[model samples]
Target: MRGNFITLEGGEGAGKSTQAGLLAAWLREQGTEVVETREPGGTPGADAIRALLLEDDVPLTATAEAHLFAAARADHVENLIRPALAEGKWVICDRFIDSTLAYQGAAGKMGVDTVRAINASAIGDTWPDLTLLLRTDGDTGTRRAIARDGAEIDRFTNREFAFHRAVAEAFDEFAATEPDRFAVIDGRNDIETVAQEIRSIVTERLK
Candidate 1:
């Protein structure tokens, strides 16, 4: 049987990476082979793309940005994600296609359909089996992200509050549209509380 592919998504500072790590550890305790990774990275090629996308100071058009993200995702899905899933290992990703939809599509004014169509060629049909949408207000999330990153905040995290708000709204819209695939979790609570809620949701939904 193919193992599950789970993706965690949210605005900045939603604790997706932390939750992904904790979830992978919990799944491992249950004797399930797990691989935890993140986007726009996972494989070496993808990681290189990620540095360009996130760290570089170059200005890219929204369309170009979307394509770069798709390129990175293509590398990640083919090299790391698909191979791990083929071996019956649960794959937990910090972000995936929806991030593209939210950031570049909706917030960046590129249109979700356009970005989705672009990603279709990149990922084919390798959608996540479960998506945990961690919810947090824009101000709180921005503050937390700034605190976490200090002076080294990424490009996305350094965007205006209105842009982040748009991203949050886009995520909510996505969860509404794909209720079956998305489990919405409040991210304002403490880390442990959020992790516990995620564990309960995973246990009940994926059992």
Candidate 2:
């Protein structure tokens, strides 16, 4: 049987990382082989790409950034993610293709279809079996993100609130389009609540 792929996606400060970790632990407890990874750095080569992509000093065009992210994902999938999944392990990703659509395309105003085409060329057309989109108000998201990593904000994060708001709105629209593949969880709650929700979703979906 093919491994189940569960991806968590959302705007900054949505608590996706914590939830992903919690889900991984729970899956392991259930005797599932879980491989937890994040976009842009799931493998050695990809981690190098991730460094360049996340640096605040470097100025890159949206297209250039998208290209690098896609490249990293291609290498990550080919070298690390795919093999682990083929072994029937649960693949838990902190962020996946939906992030590209939200950050670089929809919120960046680059056009979602274009980003989809680029991503499809990299990671194939199949969607993840489940995508948890952590939903939080943009205002709250901004404050949380700033608190979470605001001390070292990047060009992307330092952009106007309108940008992050756009990203959140885009996520909503994206989830609406593919209700089956997407699940929206309220993220304003505490970490334990978010983790419990994640644990429940994974248990229900993959159990």
Candidate 3:
């Protein structure tokens, strides 16, 4: 049997990384082998691309950025995510296809369908079985992200409020379109409360 694939998504400071860790831990405690990873990463080739996309100062047009993301995702899904799922290990990813749709596609003024088509070639049919969208207000998420990263903010995080707001709206639209595949979680709650809600959802849905 193939294991489940779960992806967590949200704008900056939405606590995706934190929730991903907690969710992976909980799943492991339930006797499931888990693999926790992040987008534009999880494999060496993808990690190199991640550096260029997030950490480096490279300038890229929206189309170029979208292509780079798709390239990294191709490597990640093929080399790491696919093998782990084949081995029956539950995969918990901090971010995935939805992030690209939200960030570069909608917020960056590129069409979501266009970006989706580009990634379709990269990931094939390996979509996540469930996606947790940790929804948060744009202002609040921006503040939290700034505080969390301090001087190390990434390229996306450095964008203006309008861009972040667009990203949030894009996420909401995606969730609305695919309610079966996405669980919209209010991210303003405390950590434990959010984690428990996620655990409950996973149990009810995946089991």
lDDT per residue (tens digit) for residues 1-207 in model 3 = 999999999998999999999999999899999999998798999999999998647788889989999999999999999999999999999999999999989999899999999999899999999999999988789889899744468888888999999999999999999999999999999999999999999998996
Q: Identify the runs in model 3 with alpha carbons over 4 angstroms from their true place.
A: 149-151
Report residue 153 deviation for candidate 3 (angstroms): 0.7
Better of 1 and 2 by lDDT: 1
Note the residue pairs that clash in candidate 1.
none
| Residue pairs with backbone overlap in model 2 | none
Which of 1 and 2 is ahead in TM-score? Answer: 1
TM per candidate: 0.97, 0.95, 0.97
Task: Report the Cα lDDT for residue 132, model 2.
Answer: 97
Q: Give, for candidate 3, the lowest lDDT window spanning 10 residues.
A: 148-157
Report the Cα lDDT for residue 4, model 2.
90
Residue 185 alpha-carbon offset, candidate 3, angstroms: 0.5
Q: For candidate 2, which ten residues in a row score worst on lDDT?
A: 148-157
Candidate 2 residue runs with Cα over 4 Å from true position: 149-151
